[model samples]
Target: MSSMTAPHPIDDQWDRFRSTLADASQLLLCLDFDGTLAPIVEEPDEASPTPENEAALASLVSASAVSTAIVSGRALADVRDRIDGPKTYAGNHGLELSRHGLVAVHPVARKRTSRLEAVCTALETVLEPVPNCRIENKRLTGTVHVRSVPRRLRPVVRRHTHAVVDRFGNDALEVSTGKRIFEIGPSIPWGKGNAVALIAADLPSETVPIYIGDDVTDESAFRIVEPDGIGIRVGGDEPSAASCRVESPTEVATVLDWLGSVGVDLLESDTSELSSVDTSSFE
Candidate 1:
């Protein structure tokens, strides 16, 4: 996990990353939905991609050499509805996936749906007193969002939430933490890493995979594409498996913009060096 930050237009580290993208025959561009594409809002339902990011993503998706996918913690249908361009999506932390117009849910996760419902039901009862604590039951998985909860009572929310989930036992469900949320899902080994690899499997062997995300849950994905592919962590100086780090979703949009413009040039036989791209404006 070599962490580097950009303080100028385009640093040497970015140039190297661009070089890799320039030489690739094909690219599988995968991104996490919430913090990666859209701003993480207090109300989860309100989160959507910024106009610039959305348009840049549309450009990448329209490219002949790029295949785009959104891998998210949101439910498959939910993320698909929120993001309209990408035909491939992995939701519920990869418990459900839609690719090539076919939808698949992990068999174990499907079977555990009833148990998850029961857990959520119990959680709602115990968490009712916590202000602004949202319990989202996404069928295959669930989340207890405490981002808007009063800071002083957040511990109470976590304690009560875990107590209810503990009653269900580890075999039936598991808990994972993110920025300010606790995700409760079917107890399984599958995650974003497995989901990314599964999606990459269908691509050409030479296709370079680029995954950008901003969550602890996304670490699995960062590790999955290491050594060869690129893993970019967004908005943190925290130690990560990601090879590169960017400050915000705004910078992410710049990266996407560069890919759409410069990438097209390189692919179409234009070998001219990319002019210095001013990233300082984004900061």
Candidate 2:
């Protein structure tokens, strides 16, 4: 595990990463939503990308050297609705992929569809009594977020949440911890790692990857990049997966800004080209 804070600003690292693309034409850029791109809002629905971020991401997506995708724990519909789908989006922890106008589909996750759906359904009962708690069913996973739960009731919510997922049989489902949520999905062997693998295979990057994320799930991505790539973990952990650590969302934005200015040479870029790569026919 490396530090979440880059040895230098993100732009510096991004410049280094971009240099690797000098000879390469293909590029795969995968970003996690929520804590990564946008500030984490108390209410999930209120979470929207800021104007600056929207512009930056729009530019990033359009970059000639890269094909960007937002891989998130969110559902296909939620991600679609949130990001206003068009670009590549892997929802439900990469179980589903939606590109441009294409319909969402779960290729790597369909195998465990039945198990995951069943678990989500059962969890509703357990969480029904938890005050202010919400069970988000993503078709491929169940997100039990206590963001809106009163602070005093958080413990009760957590206990009940764990017990509900436990009833599904641990092996059949993957229970993950998040900022203020418990994400349960098919015990499928995937996460941000699958997203990275998908992008790496498509981009043909020989320089490996440099992934920056601020979540436990991002660790899976850190593991995949390995010696070939750089893993930057945001926040902290005992044996962190990130090579560098950055403290807050504001810091992340700073890194992105730097990347655009010097790293990716994207400060004065346009989204016309990136949007031209019609992902509409893909799902």
lDDT (10s digit) by residue, model 2, range 54-120: 6776766665555667778887678767764226777877777665455545554666667777777
Q: Best candidate, TM-score-wise?
A: 1
Model 2 segments beyond 4 Å from truth? Answer: 1-27, 84-86, 99-108, 111-117, 169-171, 206-208, 236-239, 265-283
Q: Compute the lDDT for candidate 2.
A: 0.65
Taking all chains together, each candidate's TM-score versus the true structure is: 0.89, 0.77
Angstrom error at residue 170, model 1: 5.1
Overlapping backbone residue pairs in candidate 1 total 0
**Candidate 2 TM-score over all chains jointly:** 0.77
Residue range 1-283, candidate 1, lDDT tens digits:
3333322223346676667766766778899989989988999999999898999999999887788999999999899888889878999988888887778889999999998999999889889888898999999999999999999998898888778888874568888889999999877799999989988887656678889999988888888887588888887666787877777888899889988888655543432222233424322
Candidate 1: stretches off by over 4 Å: 1-12, 267-283
RMSD to the hidden true structure, all candidates: 7.7, 4.8
* N/CA/C clash count, model 2: 17
